[model samples]
Target: MKSAARHAIDLAGFEAKFRAGPDPWHTLTARDEAIKRQRILRALGDGPIARILELGSGNGSNSQALARRALKLHTCDGSASATQLTRQALADAPNAHAWHIALPAPLPGHRYEAVVIAELLYYLAPRAMQRLAKDVANALAPGARLVLAHHQIEFPDNTQRTAGIHDRFINALGRSVTKVRQFRSQRWIVDGYRA
Candidate 1:
């Protein structure tokens, strides 16, 4: 099935949502979020990662955890407010950096040992998602890992369901990046791939 054709959320919408309140998604305290975080970390494994890029810095809750495992961590989000929160959350981690980047754009030009994109893809339209998947595939170093997490439930603003989003990425990534792990709950899905 084709992904949804709805327009992706614009920068203003993200800014307003972050400005209205912190933790708008309850990522900091939600039980499911916590579980997803743990699962993502487990998928990344115990080896020290030289560099990690996180595409969606939603309040930086998950970014904080990734920072601990990576020697250098770069995280970006579409909203300035969300990026600020991520910076604050990673303040103590000298190796962590945050940027406000509207996505469906090119990824940072860096070969990373690992990349985490959580709760972000559904916000993008089909073509945007395809572009991002290609960018992500290019950014990953040989033998690098890519971890994706998304909620299973549908939202009115989402341009795709979790499966569609994941499938698009996997297809765009091609045959070289193989799936290494998968975790599914009633509300969420996490998939790990190795390049």
Candidate 2:
């Protein structure tokens, strides 16, 4: 009961923060954020991805970056304000599409060449994370890549630790996915997997 209430409060807070400020996380100015984005971009490489789905793309910062490299980019978030901000930020990018959608929900029928989930997994409950892993596997095209990145440090809003989250993700993925690369800094951990 307490957990459920806290979850609702957290979701509301995310929306409120986005409505009040475009850079709720200061992703636009943070050096750590820049480094994390650069590393994810490097993992994506120079090749043009056919389709990319980015979950929890606050203000479309990372989505805009990926839109430049992808033929089509779908960025989604639970917060309406965040989605609106993302749409506004990516308005110039013809390839990007920003939508408001909650996590652990049904994915589109089509598969994607690449999918990125950054700084969002820990917010989901354990069951939701399990469902997400399956959804990610199903949404990936053959030999497609999935990038999972999360903050290593503890935070008040997180539902699970980074290590536990990644462990469950890999467990849920089972033999269907293979890890390709991993990067760890003092602040964050990023892992790339192939399906």
lDDT of each: 0.87, 0.83
On TM-score, the leading prediction is: 1
Model 2 worst lDDT window (10 residues) = 1-10
Lowest-sum lDDT 10-residue window in model 1: 2-11
Candidate 2 lDDT by residue in tens digits, 93-170: 998888788888876536999999988988888788888888887889998888888888877667776666676787
Clashing residue pairs in candidate 2 are: none
TM-score of each: 0.93, 0.91
Specify the highest-lDDT model's number: 1
Clashes counted in candidate 2 amount to: 0
User: What does the lDDT read for residue 90 in candidate 1?
Assistant: 97
Report the lDDT tens digits of candidate 1 across residue range 1-195.
974455546678888988898798899999988999999998897878999999989789999899999999999999999999999999999999998888877776569999999999888877878888888888999999999999888776776765667877788764478889999899888999899
Q: Model 2: residues >4 Å from true position, as ranges?
A: 1-9
